[model samples]
Target: MTEKTYPKVGGRSAKITLVLLVIVYIFNFVDRQILSVLAEDIKADLN
Candidate 1:
């Protein structure tokens, strides 16, 4: 029988990438929330 090799996981780069992605997602979520809250004001200002 031959031995099978598997790909490595849980590296430093992977951790950093995950953290950055989470930060970006958090910011995007907050931005949408703020926009929604100000939607009426924005519409009035644009007119």
Candidate 2:
């Protein structure tokens, strides 16, 4: 019989992935905030 082993979760690749995810989340948050702040202005302009 043979056994297989897997690498741990907190490796370099995992850290890089986490950092990228955080950056994406930050951008998403900023985009939503900007939209919320300009919602009334946008609606007014459209109408």
In terms of TM-score, the best-performing candidate is: 1
Q: Candidate 2: global Cα-lDDT?
A: 0.96
- Tens-digit lDDT string for candidate 1 (6-42): 9998899999999999999999999999999999999
Q: List candidate 1 stretches off by more than 4 Å.
A: 1-7
Model 2, stretches more than 4 Å misplaced?
1-7
Q: What is the lDDT of residue 37 in candidate 1?
A: 100
Q: Cα deviation of 8 in candidate 1 (Å)?
A: 3.4
The number of the candidate with the highest lDDT is 1
Task: Give model 1 RMSD, 1 decimal.
Answer: 1.8
Global lDDT of each candidate: 0.98, 0.96
Q: Please, what are the lDDT tens digits per residue for candidate 2 over residues 1-47?
A: 89999877688898999999999999999999999999999999999
